[model samples]
Target: MNKPNQETLDELKAIYVQKIKAEFPKQLKNFSDKNAKEHQLSQLRGYLHKLVGSGESFGYTDITHTARAAESIATSLMSESTKDKPSRLTYLVKLLEKLAGIVDKIEIESPVTLHSGANFTDRQSNAKLLTVGQAHIAKTERKHTICVWVIDDDESVAAQLSEQLLSFGFDVAYFLSCAAFKQALLSSQPHFVIADVRLEDNSDFYRCADLHRIDLKSFGLIIMSAFDDFHARIKAVRSGAITYLQKPINVARVASFIHEHKNKIQLHPERILIIDDDTDLSALYKSQLEAAGMAVHNLSDPRKVMAAIQEYQPDLVLIDLYMPDFSGMELAAVIRQFDNFTSLPIVYISSETDNQRQSKAIATGGADEFITKPVSADILITALRTRVKRARQLNALISKDSLTGLLKHSAIKEAVKSEIARTSRDRQSLCISMLDIDRFKRVNDTYGHAVGDTVIESLANLLTQRVRQTDHVGRYGGEEFMLVMPGCDAESAQVILDDIRERFSNIEFTVGNKGFHCTVSAGFVQLEASVFLPTADSLVEHADSALYEAKNTGRNRVVQSITARI
Candidate 1:
């Protein structure tokens, strides 16, 4: 096999190290069982053989040679001829540990500048000349388009609805018949569907129910019904429609419903921000909501409420009624002024349940609903679902960047911060990294932003593909990304990130007749309970510092912060 370049070699070594660290302990634990021991020996031997073949190619000859020796001993133990089998297993385990230690000492080199790589520079040069609009056009082409199903039998209704939805920047499929809709649903697997309850026949309702049973993972469903009776609406709800809207369908209301529930359909977990001056109340709400699997952000500062909201960009904002100077009503009104938050649902949580006070709270454009204090978990969640769904609908209008399907910069920051807080409180190890496409400005300066945007999106897709399911990767800013790896330590995190770098370097991107590739630089820090227990800022700073070191050292590598000796 051909040898990997120095960069690739380092990355592979990191992966090998992580695999050894994670697998060795479990392998040892199984040693007590005779059958399990033998089975593990076989598995270890196979792994060693592969490692020997690949490790030398990545220039880790010493580690590979040791693994091969370990493999031989384990193989001998399995055959029962080796009298020192227990000792051999012990030796093998120690050798693997030694190999892991060697890998831990290897440092990731900095990424080469975008233009320095043979493929990346070409794309950069071509991205330089395009106008802003033209660049957006190119980016639009590269985005992963989500399909939406609009299932209304009325042609005029469907068309009007489709137009409204498409304006919000979604790819839409319109179906007039339930049969046609079901057929399309199989292939499209839309992110969400807007459907009418009354189909051509009663069988359509059964079909809808059937669809839910079969594709429980399908994006959220919003049903429109002509029935004014409460029982029929209740039936629709029971049948699994997240919400049932009564006709005549108001376009604005339908749009709102779609916006709020769209994310629910896609199963993006709800993010709830609780703003209360009382620490005990905040903790109470936070614990209850987290127990329900909803992400919560708690802020005790009434003065910094806006800043918290902007930072958290929560799906639902729960505020205490009374505060020192800025009351919940006042805060809601202030939030409503921002175009991005115009329809954001702000629910008041207070002791005052009097109709007059409730009416006053509701009068604030930002306050969507009021839940009296000492709110039960059930009522709170119901209010949250209502508000969050509505916020999602409002988000459809303003939150997403049309090109990448990533939350705009403002929203992404809040989401990252919330994730940081959640992971910290849960005591899970988290890896946060900042990724920058090396010399992105040069790419934009050379190829025109059109091609530049393509490269950016391609990188985003690669990051998304490479990370674990629990990880969150978002476009942080222009040409930069913020990634969160939950349940990963520094060593394990580096391995995953290095693999991403290696795979990304090999990807082929094109602009017209021109072909190109790009490399990314990342800096990451692990969240350990003892070090970064309460604050999100420290973790971010650590990662940022590491990223800076990576950029300075060279660009395509992962750097981690070194804690100072006390």
Candidate 2:
């Protein structure tokens, strides 16, 4: 995610070209031999393979293709020639001569110009392979502690909110008045400002808001008020408030709101897996792509492509078409064999220029596109970004709920089953929760289905905001939702779900001019791998039973399954 050192990259390119040129005499001698030894042929094959990868990367297409031809000949000869040896040897020798000529003529551009079209971030860490979930955890670990400043004349309100935020893992400071808050701001700023709309006759708060809008535009401002009037809301909006919360402030809701904002601002770098036998070329691709705000993993051995895919879960795969044992098309087909990866984008980035063969590769339904070698950095970035975005949109359309944008019923069930299998293997705990809006039929009858739908959307957003990136939330159907949390115990699940329950109860929904609140009941079952053999259906059923108990006792609560309570 950092800006790549173009000078370093260009220098590397120059070094590669020079290295090839220096090795030209030995390569020529090997190719000239009618009966080359296996070791000599093997060395020639390795050299040609490097050229096939790096030549195109450095924009030497002629050299890449020449090397490819020579490499093919070397491979055939090493494997015991089945073709006319004299003709093959002549062709191979000519190809090696052509490759040497191309290398001699290769030009290295100094301080290569980098495209600034994409916004790149500072990764701060060394490049490595990690799944999106693992990346999220790493990001969280590196993130600075969020500090929240609560400005309210009401001491009780400020203290209660501050305490709750502290419990929710935020550093909190409360000021009794705007003056005290302003004084603190002069010293240092908090990540968020939760200010009462009326602090000392409301005049001081408005003045403070004006100061914040002008001087501290970066920090998030959450305006809290007892008033639900249009005028008050407009004033808050004008003052650059991110959200206006009605007092009787739900701390969990505020926390969720903050998290939503954070998610929006966070840079989730695109994941890319480059499968190529050439480590040097793969390294170059990794560096260039990472500079353009993508996470890249390089795997030289095609045999480990499956393991890399499962572990790294890349958004797009860039494969060299001519690896030793398995071709890129073969690997692509293997990846497509899995239902989960059928939609994943596979692109062949090689020097292969045969149009008919390229068409055949794509027609096989394995590869999405063929990117010929010598692609400009800008073109490569644009092509990859476009493919990844479209793929995600397509995947979402197939698996996401139309109403809430969470996973659909079957998709969620499948996700649960997969997680259960993983938990069984890892011998970790898994929590499955079922949630339903309280008295949803009454809500629809009173406020109509449109308002009911709005409530459902609101809850969906809340669940998405509160859950971890590793957790899965799905619209189970209608007003019900399902949450799957791997490696979570019942007690932790209860705590999280209870907070969400309390927060949902405090979310005010307006129908016409009347503002009202809604509630939800949640039931979760935690499966201990040592004690229980978990299945998706059994987990859902137990959680549903717990939800029934929660509804029976009282609405607006979270309950752990009696059968699996820890």
Runs off by more than 4 Å, candidate 2:
5-32, 37-46, 56-268, 530-532
Overlapping backbone residue pairs in candidate 1 total: 25
Kindly list the per-residue Cα lDDT of model 2 for residues 341-366, writing each as its tens digit: 98889999876677998999887747
Q: What lDDT would each prediction earn against the true structure?
A: 0.64, 0.77
> What's model 2's lDDT at 364?
75
Q: Tell me each candidate's TM-score.
A: 0.37, 0.68
Q: Where is model 1 more than 4 Å wrong at Cα?
A: 1-265, 269-367, 370-386, 393-428, 462-476, 531-542, 548-555, 564-566
